[model samples]
Target: MKKYFLKLYQYNAWSNKRVLGTLQRQNVNDPKILSLMGHVVAAQFLWLHRIKGLPPPDVKLWGEYSLDQLLKLSEKAGKEWLEFVESNDNFDRQLTYTNYVGEPYTNNVEMIMVHLVNHSSYHRAQVAMLLRQKGFEPINTDFITYDRVITGQLKE
Candidate 1:
């Protein structure tokens, strides 16, 4: 499960970098794209910490940051997430956490992990659409493509 999530994370990081570069090269002036990426990262941090029974992250919204800065922050966040996964074994699952809507949810660690990936994937798709609406070419981030890139073969 960790490996799967890690693969998704790595692919996400790559896709974001591609989009960020496109925005930079095209000289995009809107900061909302960066803000959206920040939201994605912030949400991941909040959910992962919640699942791990840790304090939530403090980011309320995305802020202005150069592409390099955002990438660095993402790297840091990814490292923390990886460490959290490393500390837990498969038996440590089913954490209880509250959602923003004040609903109680009991989620296994693996489910929560997949949720994080899917959550990010959904938002990243939003970012891509937002970019396309603004006339930028967003990178294609299909999971199969990522697997092919990682394994050096076209995966079915």
Candidate 2:
């Protein structure tokens, strides 16, 4: 289980970097893309804090961020999540945390980790869609793409 999650986290980090790089290369400053990416980064941090049994940070979920800021935060979140997954082996441990709306919920570590990756993937697709609508070609950040690159079947 740990090995599986570690691979997922590795792919998550790679895909995030790809998306951020594409945005930078295209000089994309679309407000929707920025907002969506910001939310993704913020949510990663929020979940990390929750998983560590800490209170959520006081910040807007959809706060505006400059491209550079988003890139930095995304990099930080990716590294931290990778480290967290690598160091923790208790995937079945239950975590109880409060939602942003003050609702309480309990979920195991494995489920939360999966949700984190899937959540980012969902927003990344949104970012891709917005880029396409603006006549920009979206970078391929699929899991298979990452796998192929890692296996030397494709160039990154």
Q: Please report the TM-score between candidate 2 and the true structure.
A: 0.96
lDDT per residue (tens digit) for residues 49-68 in model 2: 99997778654689999899
Off by over 4 Å in 2: none
Q: Which pairs of residues clash in candidate 1, taking residues 3 or more apart in a chain or in different chains?
A: none
- In model 1, state the lDDT of residue 123: 75
- Model 1: C-alpha RMSD to truth? 3.3
Query: Per-residue lDDT tens digits of candidate 1, residues 52-154?
Result: 6777676554556666666676767777776766565562467888876679888777777777778778877887898889888777777777778778795
lDDT of each: 0.71, 0.90
